[model samples]
Target: MYTPKDFVESRLPVLHDAIRANAFGTLVTAGEGGIEATHVPFVLARDEGPMGTLYAHVARGNDHVARHAGEVLSMFTGPHAYISPNGYPGKATHHREVPTWNYIAVHAYGTAETFTDPDRLLDLLSRLTEQSEHDTGQAQPWKLSDAPADYVAPMLRGIVGIRIPIARIEGKWKLGQNRPAADREGSARLLEQCPGDNEQAIAEAMRSV
Candidate 1:
């Protein structure tokens, strides 16, 4: 991530927030042939290290996991939108600005390792399900144990568990931090007025940031 000083998110808390908001991350690893990537929902454990621990899994038969054990990069992408020059007040001055993308993304580079332990896999699945529905106060929360043992056992065999010990974390908040104040304000207004949920959220981000 070639981030300029103006767009770097050095604050650990801010970086964590971005990762949490976008838990589904891209897992990248280098292999004997080349690089491979898989999209997976990750659990980030903050207490585990200075950065954190990342948990995710893939299908057991996944051939991509076999060739790599080196460093892995997990990318978390947040609200992203395009800022149009039309939003700028400087349009009246004919400043002629190019459109740019505003977004928040967190990249975690870590050591990749696999977990084949049945107990660990069960625990990880339970944790993942809970995290998925943590906001809902479901008295009978869904669990891996809910399924029949026979079914659960077979299902577990189909997946491979992984833990990535985070070595470095980088965050990028390209929310017009490098742009002029007037242009940024105009972009916010323009994006907010546009259609769709993603763009609206992006607009709100520009204003708040």
Candidate 2:
């Protein structure tokens, strides 16, 4: 991540929030077959380690897990939107403004390992289901126990679990931090009026900053 000084976000709490909010991340690994990437939802354990840990899974048929070694990179992307030059107050004065993009992103680096134990796999599945269901406000969340053991057992056998103990994390929130105060305010106002959810989110972030 090539983040400028003004856009860098190093606070662990902020990084954790971004990871939790955008749990679906791209997992990248380099091996003999070159680089392979997989998009998957992750479960972040904020207090599990000095730098935290991430949990996810891959299909048994996906051979990427078998080749995963050393350090892996997990990228989480948050709200992003286009900012037009028209939104900058200085555009009218000097015509120096240009269109840009604002976004929030987090990159986590860590050692990745795979687990195939049935017990651990079942526990991982259960935790994933619970967290997803809770997020959706389901009154009666679905459970692995809802299905017959024979059916669930076979299904669980089809995937491999992954764990990454984060060694380092970096976050970038490019929310007009480099822009002048007046220009940032103008951009936020224009973005807030836009109908896109991402634009509105950027507007809110700008205002908060």
TM-scores for the candidates: 0.92, 0.96
Error of 1 at 140 (Å): 6.2
Reference-based lDDT, each prediction: 0.84, 0.91
Which pairs clash in model 2?
A: none
Error (Å) of candidate 2 at residue 139 is 2.9
Give the best candidate by TM-score: 2
The prediction achieving the highest lDDT against the true structure is 2
Among all windows of 10 consecutive residues in model 2, the one with the lowest summed lDDT is 62-71
TM-score of 1: 0.92
True lDDT of residue 103, candidate 1: 87
> Model 1's lDDT to the true fold?
0.84
